[model samples]
Target chain A: MAFRTDHHLTGSVNIVTALPAEARPLVGHFELRSSRTDPFSVYTNGDSSVRLIVSGVGKSAAGRAVKHLAGLFDSTGSNAWLNVGIAGHESLPLGTMVAAHKISDEKTGRSWFPPMVLDFPCETATLLTVEEETDDYPDNALVEMEAVGFYATASDFSTHELIHCLKVVSDNRREKKLDGKSVSELITAQLAAVESVVQSILQLSAELGKRRVVPRQLKDFLEQWKFTVTQSHQLEKLLRRWEVIFPKADPFEAASPESRNGRDVVQLLSRQLAEASVEAEQL
Target chain B: MIEAIYIEEAVRQHRRTAEILTRFPKARLIPCERYGEVFNPRSQDFKIQKRRPALILAEKFDNFVLPTPDGFGIGGTENYYFSHMLNCLYDCRYCFLQGMFRSAHYLLFVNYESFMDAIDSTLDKSTTDKTVTFFSGYDCDSLALETVTGFAEAFLPFFRERPRALHELRTKSVNIQALLKTEPLDNCVTAFSFTPAEISEKVEHGVPPVKRRIEAMKQLAERGWPLGLRLDPLIYHGRFESNYRRLVNDLFAAVPAEAFHSVSLGAMRFPKAMFDPMVKLYPDELLLAGPLHPSNGMVTYRREVEEEMTQFCRSLLGDYLPAEKFFHCAPWS
Candidate 1:
C-alpha cells in the first residue's frame, strides 16, 4: 500500500496488553522495540495506514506509543489512535469484548479518557486504567494499561480522529486466574469481527481527514502572541499540536498568526499590558 | 481579554437568570426570550439535550472563588475551586460533562468583577494566617480558555493582595503563554494534570502532549511559579512500573523535585450513578476493560489492586518528595 499524507489509517486496533501471547496469532506479524526511538513497521490497507506497535505495557509506555504513532502521521494529516488489546472483566461473562468508554489512572485519579467509547449497537462503559492487575477495581469493569496514555498523548498530536479500543475479556474476578493460551484462543475466534472493526475505523478516519479546521479559539490565541505562521508551526510542531492539523494550511498562512491575536488581546487588557508596552518601546 | 457585554431580557424575571447576569457586566448581552431552542431530548442519547447547551452570557458573578471538593487537598485544608467558563472544547469519551449537563453549549460567565468581590468576602471570612486556597480550572481548564477569558491574569492581582491565600490553577491545557508573560507568584501554584505519554495519545482527546506539558511546567518553574505534578487517573497496563517510572523520570528530569510545590496521585473511581451512562457512551475503551468491583458505592478498581498501586506509587513519589508531602485519595491507613 502506498502512503498518502491525506489518507488516514483507522482501526489500528492496537492490542495494548500484557497478553501479547493472546494477540500474536490474531494480528499480522508483530514488531517490538525497547522504546519509541526504534524504527517501526506500519500495515497499509491500500487506502489507509495501520501500525501495530507493541507499546510496552503501562501508562508511560502507552503514552510513548501514542506519541510515536502520532509522529508517524503528518501532524497536519488525519490520524486515528487506537489501543486494541485484551482486558479483565467483572460483571460480564468471560470472553466479552469491552470498549473502554473512559480511561482513568488508578495512580493519579485525574481522568484522560474520552466519554464512553459509545457503541450504540453494543454495551459500552468506562474502562479504568490501573497500574496493577487485580480484582479490586472500584467502579470500572475492564482493566488495561495503555488506553489513557494513548488517548492523552495522541489527542495532543492529532485533533479528533483517534478511535478503537477493542478489549476481549481475559480474566474474571470469579475465576481469579489468567490462562494466556486460552485467552489467545478467544481472540482468534473473534478475528473476523476485529477485522471489520478495524476497517470501519479506517473509513471513519478518511472521512474526518477532509477539511479539518483548527478551532478559531486556538487560532486566535496564536495570532495575538505574534507567532508567525512558521513560528506558530514551530511551536506547535514542538508541542505536536500542529502534527494532525498541519500539512494543510501553508504553515505560513494568516490563521497561525491570528491565533496569537487572542493572546495579544488579553495582554493588552491586563495591567500587565503596561509592562509589555514599555518593553515594546525599548524594542 | 474577552470583549464581553451582557444583555438582560424578560428572562431576568427568573431569579437564577437575573443572579447569573448581575455577575458579568463586560459581557455583550445578547437578549433573546430564549437561548438557542435546540435543547430538547432525543431517545437514543440521553446526554445531549434537544436544545444546545445553555449559554449564560452574564455581566458578573456573586463570587469568583469557590471551595474545593472535600478530601481534595493533598496537604492543605483551606481549599477552593473556581471557573471562568463552563464546558471544554475537546470532546473526550469519558468526560463527565456528558452526564452532568443537559446541553453541550458553553456557558461563559463574563462577569469578572462580581467574582472578585466575592473573593474579597471569602478572604475576609477566613483567618489571614490560614492559607485560603482558591482553585481555578475546575469546570474548565484554567488556562485553556484564558486566551478568550483572561481569567488568570484578571485574578492574579486579587490573589496577590492576600498572599496568605494560596491559588492553585489546575488544568490539562498547555496554554502557558499567559503564565509565561507575567512574573511568577509565590502564592500561586500552576498545576498541570499529566498522564503517561502513551495513555495521553490514545485517550486524552484534545489535550496537549506529555512532553509539551513538561515543557510548560519547566517554563513555569523557571519563571518561579510553584509547580505541581498531578499524576491523575493512573491507567494500568502491563510492565506498568517501567512506564510510570519513565514518566516520573521524564518529569523530574525536566524540573527539579525542589521546584515542585507538591505531587498528587489517585486512581480511576467515579460515583456509582455516573458509571452506567458513561459506559453507554464508550463501549470500546480498554481502560474500561477489567473486573469492576465497587467499594462503598463508588465505582473503582477492587480494593487490593487499588491499594497495591497506591502503595507502589507512593513509594515512587517518595523517591522525589518526603513521605509527609505525598497525599492519597483513599484515606486508608
Candidate 2:
C-alpha cells in the first residue's frame, strides 16, 4: 500500500500483544476502541495515533500483526512500537514489571539489544523468547514466547531507540501457570507504569518529529513551480538552508522576476546564502 | 552517570573489567558475545544515546596502535595515535565522533597489556632516531574519565620507563586530581584544548568552563608538568578577533610560556561525509549554517576567511611564544 503523505500520525504509538488478556488493560487504559477485526483485532484511540493489536499467541503471530499495523500508516513518520505482555521468570514475584534490555531467540540463538535512551520507569532484564510455553526460565532472565518476533519485526519499521518491550511477571518458580483472568489482573495492576512508559516514548517521538519537520514554505514553492524527482530534493535542501541562514527573512524576497524555474530559484538562494556573513547574534 | 554496563563474554573475567565494574555496583549488567553486537548497529541514534550512554567493556583483538594522519604532529618525526576508548563523555557539536560512529555508548577496551606490548613493538621497530610522539585522546578524551578508567594511572608508568618516547594526554576536562597526586614526568605533556567563551558556551555542551580548565592548567604548570595548548577548529564570528584576543590574554596570564612544550592551531573543517551527517543532525545549527562549501572532498570556510583567521591568531600568539613552539595543523592539506 502507498504511504500517506500527510503527517497526521506523527509521534504515534503502535502496541502489540500476544494475548487478548494481556492487551485488555492497555486498550482500556488508553481508551482505545475497536478499529479492525477481520484478520486480526486492532484498537485505536480518538485520533488513531495510539493503536493496540492482539496477535493471539506465538512468535509468528506477533510478527505478522506488527507488519500489518505498520502497513496501515505512514511508516516514515516518527512512531513508536511497543510489545506489552506477560512473561515467566525464575525468582521475581508476580506482578513485577520489567523492560527488556536484551532479547535472545532460543531457536536461532540470535540476540538483539534494545538501546535504552530514556529514564525508564521500571527495572530492566534479559528476555529469552522460546518456541513453546515452558516453566524453564533461565537464570536472571525472563522467558516469553513472542518478544523476539515482535522486536525483530518492529526494528525494520522504526529505529531501535523507539522500539521497546515491557513485560509483567505473571508466572514464576512458585506459580508456573496462570489463567486468562489472572493474566488480565496482572497487566491491570501495572497500568500506571505502562502509561508512564507510553508518555515517555511519545515525548521522545515528538522531539524527533520536530527535528524532521519540513519548512512550511516548501509546499507553496512546490505548488508554484514544476520540479522533477531529483529537482524536488534539491529544492527542499536549498529551502532548508535558506531557512537556517535567513531565518527571519523570506526566500521569496530574494527571487528575481527573471527567475523561470525551480533550478533558477535554487541557484538564486544558493548565491544569496554564499554571500551572507554569519553573525554572532544568529547563533 | 552510567545506567547500564555491557560486558563482552571474552573480557568478562579480565582484571581491569572487574576493577571497573566495582565502581558502578548499581548499574545493570548485560552480557554479550561481542561489543560490536551492541555498538555497530545501524538503527541506533547517537543524539538520543548521548543522553544516557552505557559503558561497554571489551577486548581489542588487533590494531592497538596506528600512525596519525599527515600534518597532525607537533615536533616528532614519527607520530602515532591509539584509542583505549571509543567515544568521549562530552557532546561537542563539531566533534567528528558524532559522524564517525552510529552509537554513542562508550566502548572501552580492557586489554591494557596488549596495548603496552604493541607500543613496545612499535618503539623497537622505529626507523628514525628522532623522538616518536604517542598521542592519546584522538578517539576519546584521555583524562575525562580518569577516575573510572584509571587510564593515566595504568599507562603513565609505561611511558616513564621509555624516556625517549613522548606521551600527550589531550583533554578539555578539569578532572586533574589524578595528575596532581602522581609525580610529574618530563616525557608526558598534558595538553588542553580551548575556544572562546562565547563559542564554548554554545557548542561545547557538558564541557568544563574555560576558567576552570585554565585553573587546572595553572595547577599542573606549578607542579613542573609541561603543558601544550591546542587552539584548534577556530570558529568564525563578527567579533572573532576581539574574543580570541581576550582568550589568549587570559590563558597567558594564568600560565607562563616557559612551561609550554608546543602550541598548534587549526581551522574548522570536516570531510564531506562527516559534515553531511552533522548538518542533518542539527539543520538549524548556526555553525553549520555558516559560509561553508565543499572543497577537495572537505567542507570548510571560504579560503579568505580561513587564512584571515589563521594569520590573525598566529600573529597574536607569536607576541608571547617563540617561533619553534608554533605549528599549523591542516589535516586536509
Candidate 3:
C-alpha cells in the first residue's frame, strides 16, 4: 500500500530544540541497547511526539538513525520524515536558529539535503555536512554532520513535500568551546518549540493526501489516441460528404423523390454507421 | 540563375507584401537602420505570429556570409550553412529559432545579388574540389516563403550548374508547389522534418498538420526529387515509443521506402545560457519535462535519457530505412 494513502502529517515547522536540563520532563520512554553505548531516548510533550534514536556520534550513526526511522515508518504506516538535530555555525551568534536551503558535501560536491523553504525572519543558506571532526567551517553559514545523510536516506521513503531537515545552531566551530551541560539543557528547554513544528508538518501532510489521485482515465484516453492521418482524414471527408448530401432536412419543404429522398437514404445509413463506430469504441 | 540587383527601396512591391497590405492596410512600413536590427530583432510578438508568415523587406549589405559551425560537413570535410533570412513562419515550440533570436519578425534581406556574389567568391576560393554544402533552412523554412520570394526558382539552377555543390532545403512546410512547378535539380535535396501526429498536433503550433506534410512528401518523392528525413530534436514523452513507431509506419506507407537519400537523428541539446530565455518563452512546454541536467556547457536531457531516445528512434527508423543510410548527429559519449 502507498504510505500516503494511510497516514498523513502537516506543519509549518519541522523541528524545535530544548535544552538538556529542560529535556528530562519531556522524555516519554527510554531503551538501553548496551552499557557501553549511548541510550536511545524517546520524547513527547502530549501535543507533539518524536524519538531521538542515539546511534553514537558519527556519519554512519546519523545514516543508521535515518534507516531505523524509515523502517519505523514502513512498519507503522507513518507518512512523514523529519530530521531534528543540533548544528555548529560560523560567524552567527550561538542559540540563533537558521534554516538550511541546501546541504552539500564539501569533499565530493554532491548535494544531500533538499532546498529549504523558510518563513520570514528565518535566513536560508548552505549547510555543509562533513565526515571530519572539528574542522574550520569553510565560508558557509552552517556546519552539521548528520542532517545530509538523514535527508538523503529519508527522501526515498517520503515525498519531497513531506520530508524536512531542521538544524538548530548549538556550537561555533571556530571558537571550539562549548559548555556541554548547558548545550544539553538548551535542547530540553526548546522541546515545546520543536513539538509545535511537527504539529504543523502533520497538517501539511493531510492536505497532500487529499490532492493525490491516480489518472487512470487520462491514461486510457492517451493510450487510444491514434496517430494515423489517413483514418482521421477519411472520417473528416465522409462527414463532409454527409453534410453536403443531406443539407439538414428542410422543415418548410416536402421531401422530393429525385433529390432529397435519395440523398436522405444515403445520409441516414452514414449516420448509423458513425453512431455504431462510436458505440463500438466505447465498449 | 539570372543576375538581380539589391536596392534600398522605401517600399516593397512583392505579392506577399501586397497580401499583407490587404490584410493590415494601415500597417506602417517602418524603415530599419540595419538588417541585423530586424533579423536578430530586439522586439516583436513571438507568440502572436502565425505560420506562412509575411516578411518586412529590407536591403542586405556587403557582408552576406560568415563561418559555419565546426565539423558541419554535409557530404565532405568542408560543409557550411548560411541563412539568408531570420526566424521561421512555423511556430513549433521545440524549434531552436525561438531560443536563438529575441524577436519573431520575418526579416527578408532583399539583397539576392550580394548573397549570390559571396557564394560565387566562396566557391571560387575553395577550388571546388571538396563539396561545398549550402544549407538554406537553418533559420527559416526554405520554401514556405518561396511562392512570393521565388527563392528556390532562382537558387535551383545555380546548384544545378555547379554539380560539385549540394544544397539542402530543409522544411516542415507543404510549400513545395513552387519547387514542384520548376524542373527538379539533381544536386539539390528537399529535406523534410517530421514528427508523429500526436506530438505534432500538441507542439507544432501554426504549421500545416502532419497529414498535409505527408501528402507533400509523397508527391515530391514520386516526382523523383531526392528527399532527406530529419528526426532531429527527438522529443521523448509518454507513449513516445509507440507514437514514433506509428509515425514511421505511416510515412513508409505513404511513400516508397527506397526514395529517401539519407536520414539524420539528433536528440535535443541546447546551450546552458539558452535555458532561462527559452523557459521564459515556453514555461509550460513538455519538451523540457524529461530528466534534464546541465552537462559541460549545455542543458540537455541527461546522457542516459538522450541515449534512450536516440536508440529508440534509431531502431524505429531501421524498420523502414537501411541501417547504413541512418546517421546519428548526436555528440558521442
Against the true structure, whose TM-score is highest?
2
True contacts kept of 2: 0.61
Q: Which candidate has the top score in lDDT?
A: 2
Model 1 segments beyond 4 Å from truth?
A1-283, B1-56, B59-65, B328-333
lDDT of 2 by residue, B292-314 (tens): 76679998888898889989998
Per-model C-alpha lDDT, please? 0.57, 0.86, 0.56
| Model 3 CA RMSD to the hidden true structure, in angstroms | 21.3
Q: Candidate 3, residues B23-86: lDDT per residue as tens digits? A: 4443323333344433342322243232223355666666676545665434555555667777
Model 1 C-alpha lDDT per residue in residues B17-129, reported as the tens digit of each score? 46544555543333332222212212113223211223444443345676655677756667776676766755554455565554454556656666777766787888646
Return the lDDT, model 1, position B265: 81
Q: Which ten residues in a row have the lowest lDDT in candidate 1 chain A?
A: A274-283
- Tell me how far the alpha carbon of residue B250 in candidate 2 is from the true structure, in angstroms, after superposition: 0.8
Clash count, predicted structure 2: 0
Error of 2 at B217 (Å): 1.4
Candidate 1 CAPRI grade: incorrect
Candidate 2 TM-score versus the reference: 0.96
**iRMSD for every model:** 21.6, 1.6, 20.3
Residue A270 Cα positional deviation in candidate 1, in Å, after optimal superposition: 55
Query: What is the DockQ score, from 0 to 1, of model 2?
Result: 0.64
